[model samples]
Target: MCKAFEEWQEECIQKGEIIGALKTYKKCSFAKEETLKNIITDFSLSEEDAQNCMEKYW
Candidate 1:
Protein backbone atom coordinates (compact mmCIF):
# COMPACT_ATOMS: atom_id res chain seq x y z
CA MET A 1 0.00 0.00 0.00
CA CYS A 2 1.23 3.49 -0.75
CA LYS A 3 1.08 4.91 2.75
CA ALA A 4 2.83 8.14 1.94
CA PHE A 5 3.12 10.60 -0.89
CA GLU A 6 6.82 9.89 -1.42
CA GLU A 7 6.17 6.17 -1.74
CA TRP A 8 3.35 6.79 -4.19
CA GLN A 9 5.53 9.09 -6.24
CA GLU A 10 8.26 6.51 -6.45
CA GLU A 11 5.81 3.84 -7.53
CA CYS A 12 4.43 6.11 -10.23
CA ILE A 13 7.90 6.96 -11.45
CA GLN A 14 8.89 3.31 -11.69
CA LYS A 15 5.75 2.39 -13.61
CA GLY A 16 6.22 5.38 -15.87
CA GLU A 17 9.77 4.43 -16.62
CA ILE A 18 8.78 0.88 -17.48
CA ILE A 19 5.95 2.04 -19.72
CA GLY A 20 8.14 4.66 -21.38
CA ALA A 21 10.79 2.09 -22.17
CA LEU A 22 8.24 -0.22 -23.72
CA LYS A 23 6.75 2.62 -25.74
CA THR A 24 10.13 3.54 -27.14
CA TYR A 25 10.78 -0.06 -28.03
CA LYS A 26 7.55 -0.22 -29.99
CA LYS A 27 7.38 3.27 -31.49
CA CYS A 28 11.05 3.93 -32.21
CA SER A 29 11.95 0.45 -33.46
CA PHE A 30 14.69 0.06 -30.94
CA ALA A 31 16.12 -3.42 -31.02
CA LYS A 32 15.34 -5.65 -28.05
CA GLU A 33 18.92 -5.52 -26.90
CA GLU A 34 19.06 -1.75 -27.24
CA THR A 35 15.84 -1.32 -25.31
CA LEU A 36 17.11 -3.45 -22.48
CA LYS A 37 20.37 -1.54 -22.46
CA ASN A 38 18.55 1.77 -22.44
CA ILE A 39 16.27 0.70 -19.62
CA ILE A 40 19.22 -0.20 -17.47
CA THR A 41 21.40 2.76 -18.41
CA ASP A 42 18.91 5.52 -18.97
CA PHE A 43 16.73 4.67 -15.99
CA SER A 44 19.52 3.83 -13.57
CA LEU A 45 17.99 0.44 -12.94
CA SER A 46 19.88 -2.77 -12.26
CA GLU A 47 20.26 -5.66 -14.73
CA GLU A 48 17.82 -7.72 -12.72
CA ASP A 49 15.31 -4.91 -12.62
CA ALA A 50 15.52 -4.40 -16.37
CA GLN A 51 15.23 -8.10 -17.02
CA ASN A 52 12.19 -8.33 -14.76
CA CYS A 53 10.50 -5.59 -16.72
CA MET A 54 11.27 -7.38 -19.96
CA GLU A 55 9.94 -10.64 -18.61
CA LYS A 56 6.71 -8.99 -17.59
CA TYR A 57 6.17 -6.51 -20.42
CA TRP A 58 8.39 -7.26 -23.42
Candidate 2:
Protein backbone atom coordinates (compact mmCIF):
# COMPACT_ATOMS: atom_id res chain seq x y z
CA MET A 1 0.00 0.00 0.00
CA CYS A 2 2.84 2.34 0.82
CA LYS A 3 4.53 1.59 -2.48
CA ALA A 4 1.28 2.17 -4.32
CA PHE A 5 0.76 5.51 -2.59
CA GLU A 6 4.30 6.54 -3.34
CA GLU A 7 3.86 5.73 -7.00
CA TRP A 8 0.54 7.50 -7.14
CA GLN A 9 2.02 10.52 -5.45
CA GLU A 10 4.80 10.64 -7.99
CA GLU A 11 2.36 10.24 -10.83
CA CYS A 12 0.21 13.06 -9.48
CA ILE A 13 3.24 15.30 -9.24
CA GLN A 14 4.28 14.46 -12.77
CA LYS A 15 0.79 15.28 -13.99
CA GLY A 16 0.82 18.66 -12.24
CA GLU A 17 -1.55 17.57 -9.55
CA ILE A 18 0.19 18.73 -6.43
CA ILE A 19 -3.00 19.13 -4.46
CA GLY A 20 -4.15 15.69 -5.45
CA ALA A 21 -0.89 14.18 -4.38
CA LEU A 22 -1.03 15.95 -1.03
CA LYS A 23 -4.60 14.85 -0.51
CA THR A 24 -3.67 11.29 -1.31
CA TYR A 25 -0.80 11.45 1.12
CA LYS A 26 -3.14 12.84 3.70
CA LYS A 27 -5.36 9.83 3.23
CA CYS A 28 -2.60 7.26 3.44
CA SER A 29 -2.96 4.58 6.13
CA PHE A 30 0.33 2.69 5.71
CA ALA A 31 2.69 5.50 6.41
CA LYS A 32 5.02 3.77 8.82
CA GLU A 33 8.55 4.81 9.70
CA GLU A 34 10.14 2.92 6.81
CA THR A 35 7.54 4.24 4.44
CA LEU A 36 8.07 7.77 5.65
CA LYS A 37 11.81 7.38 5.23
CA ASN A 38 11.29 6.18 1.69
CA ILE A 39 8.98 9.10 1.00
CA ILE A 40 11.60 11.53 2.31
CA THR A 41 14.31 9.98 0.18
CA ASP A 42 12.19 9.63 -2.93
CA PHE A 43 11.06 13.25 -2.77
CA SER A 44 14.36 14.58 -1.55
CA LEU A 45 12.60 16.07 1.43
CA SER A 46 14.26 17.05 4.67
CA GLU A 47 13.51 15.00 7.76
CA GLU A 48 11.76 18.02 9.29
CA ASP A 49 9.71 18.49 6.16
CA ALA A 50 8.74 14.80 6.08
CA GLN A 51 7.73 14.88 9.73
CA ASN A 52 5.74 18.01 9.12
CA CYS A 53 3.96 16.38 6.21
CA MET A 54 3.08 13.34 8.31
CA GLU A 55 1.90 15.50 11.16
CA LYS A 56 -0.26 17.60 8.88
CA TYR A 57 -1.73 14.59 7.17
CA TRP A 58 -1.89 11.77 9.68
Candidate 3:
Protein backbone atom coordinates (compact mmCIF):
# COMPACT_ATOMS: atom_id res chain seq x y z
CA MET A 1 0.00 0.00 0.00
CA CYS A 2 1.19 3.47 -0.83
CA LYS A 3 0.88 6.03 1.96
CA ALA A 4 0.08 9.61 1.15
CA PHE A 5 1.60 12.80 2.50
CA GLU A 6 -1.53 13.59 4.55
CA GLU A 7 -1.22 10.21 6.14
CA TRP A 8 2.35 10.96 7.18
CA GLN A 9 1.95 13.60 9.86
CA GLU A 10 5.19 14.77 11.47
CA GLU A 11 7.53 17.75 11.29
CA CYS A 12 10.42 15.48 10.42
CA ILE A 13 8.60 14.75 7.19
CA GLN A 14 8.78 17.64 4.73
CA LYS A 15 5.27 16.97 3.42
CA GLY A 16 3.78 17.20 6.87
CA GLU A 17 5.72 20.35 7.63
CA ILE A 18 4.40 22.01 4.50
CA ILE A 19 0.85 21.07 5.36
CA GLY A 20 1.26 22.34 8.91
CA ALA A 21 2.72 25.64 7.78
CA LEU A 22 -0.10 26.22 5.29
CA LYS A 23 -2.75 25.30 7.85
CA THR A 24 -1.15 27.62 10.39
CA TYR A 25 -1.14 30.44 7.89
CA LYS A 26 -4.84 29.99 7.28
CA LYS A 27 -5.59 30.43 10.98
CA CYS A 28 -3.11 33.26 11.55
CA SER A 29 -3.13 36.82 10.22
CA PHE A 30 0.27 36.51 8.56
CA ALA A 31 0.52 37.77 4.99
CA LYS A 32 0.96 35.30 2.13
CA GLU A 33 4.32 36.70 1.12
CA GLU A 34 5.60 36.51 4.66
CA THR A 35 4.31 32.98 5.03
CA LEU A 36 6.02 31.95 1.81
CA LYS A 37 9.23 33.63 2.93
CA ASN A 38 9.10 31.85 6.25
CA ILE A 39 8.38 28.53 4.55
CA ILE A 40 11.40 28.92 2.32
CA THR A 41 13.59 30.05 5.19
CA ASP A 42 12.36 27.45 7.64
CA PHE A 43 12.35 24.49 5.24
CA SER A 44 15.11 25.62 2.94
CA LEU A 45 12.72 24.99 0.06
CA SER A 46 13.50 26.48 -3.30
CA GLU A 47 11.46 29.46 -4.48
CA GLU A 48 9.61 27.31 -7.00
CA ASP A 49 9.06 24.54 -4.49
CA ALA A 50 7.79 27.06 -1.94
CA GLN A 51 5.35 28.51 -4.41
CA ASN A 52 4.18 25.07 -5.45
CA CYS A 53 3.75 24.04 -1.86
CA MET A 54 1.68 27.17 -1.26
CA GLU A 55 -0.48 26.39 -4.26
CA LYS A 56 -1.11 22.81 -3.20
CA TYR A 57 -1.41 23.31 0.54
CA TRP A 58 -2.70 26.88 0.75
Candidate 4:
Protein backbone atom coordinates (compact mmCIF):
# COMPACT_ATOMS: atom_id res chain seq x y z
CA MET A 1 0.00 0.00 0.00
CA CYS A 2 0.97 3.65 -0.41
CA LYS A 3 1.04 4.19 3.30
CA ALA A 4 3.47 1.30 3.75
CA PHE A 5 5.74 2.65 1.05
CA GLU A 6 5.61 6.10 2.63
CA GLU A 7 6.49 4.69 6.01
CA TRP A 8 9.28 2.58 4.53
CA GLN A 9 10.70 5.64 2.82
CA GLU A 10 10.62 7.59 6.05
CA GLU A 11 12.32 4.82 7.94
CA CYS A 12 14.99 4.51 5.29
CA ILE A 13 15.73 8.23 5.54
CA GLN A 14 15.80 8.07 9.32
CA LYS A 15 18.38 5.32 8.99
CA GLY A 16 20.48 7.26 6.43
CA GLU A 17 19.62 4.78 3.72
CA ILE A 18 19.09 6.74 0.50
CA ILE A 19 19.32 3.68 -1.71
CA GLY A 20 16.71 1.84 0.29
CA ALA A 21 14.34 4.76 0.15
CA LEU A 22 14.76 5.02 -3.61
CA LYS A 23 14.22 1.28 -4.05
CA THR A 24 11.07 1.40 -1.99
CA TYR A 25 9.81 4.38 -3.98
CA LYS A 26 10.36 2.43 -7.17
CA LYS A 27 8.15 -0.35 -5.83
CA CYS A 28 5.17 1.92 -5.38
CA SER A 29 2.76 1.10 -8.21
CA PHE A 30 0.04 3.71 -7.85
CA ALA A 31 -0.06 7.38 -8.75
CA LYS A 32 3.57 7.49 -9.76
CA GLU A 33 3.29 10.92 -11.36
CA GLU A 34 1.79 12.34 -8.21
CA THR A 35 4.48 10.69 -6.17
CA LEU A 36 7.21 12.01 -8.43
CA LYS A 37 5.73 15.46 -8.18
CA ASN A 38 5.73 15.19 -4.44
CA ILE A 39 9.35 14.10 -4.47
CA ILE A 40 10.31 17.01 -6.68
CA THR A 41 8.49 19.47 -4.48
CA ASP A 42 9.64 18.01 -1.20
CA PHE A 43 13.28 17.67 -2.17
CA SER A 44 13.46 20.66 -4.49
CA LEU A 45 14.51 18.30 -7.23
CA SER A 46 14.07 18.94 -10.90
CA GLU A 47 11.74 16.88 -13.09
CA GLU A 48 14.85 15.59 -14.84
CA ASP A 49 16.19 14.42 -11.51
CA ALA A 50 13.03 12.46 -10.91
CA GLN A 51 13.24 10.91 -14.39
CA ASN A 52 16.87 9.99 -13.88
CA CYS A 53 16.13 8.39 -10.53
CA MET A 54 13.31 6.37 -12.08
CA GLU A 55 15.53 5.24 -14.94
CA LYS A 56 18.27 4.21 -12.57
CA TYR A 57 15.99 2.29 -10.22
CA TRP A 58 13.38 0.93 -12.61
- Best-fitting candidate, scored by lDDT: 3
lDDT of 1 by residue, 1-58 (tens): 5469889899898888788778869688888888889889887889998888888887
Residues 1-55 of candidate 2 have per-residue lDDT tens digits of 6999999987767434323445565567544576567657767778887677666
Best-fitting candidate, scored by TM-score: 3
Compared with the true structure, all predictions reach lDDT values of 0.83, 0.63, 0.84, 0.64
- Residue 42's lDDT within candidate 4 is 61
lDDT of 4 by residue, 1-58 (tens): 6999999988667434434455566677536676667666666668997667656654
lDDT of 3 by residue, 1-58 (tens): 3456555544358788688988998789788899999999999999999999899888
> What is the Å distance of residue 6 in model 3 from its true position?
17
TM value for model 2: 0.47
Clashes of each: 0, 0, 0, 0
TM-score of 1: 0.73
TM-score of each: 0.73, 0.47, 0.74, 0.48
The model with the greater TM-score, 2 or 3, is 3
Model 4, global lDDT: 0.64
Question: Which prediction has more favorable TM-score, 1 or 4?
Answer: 1
Ten-residue segment with the worst summed lDDT in candidate 1? 17-26
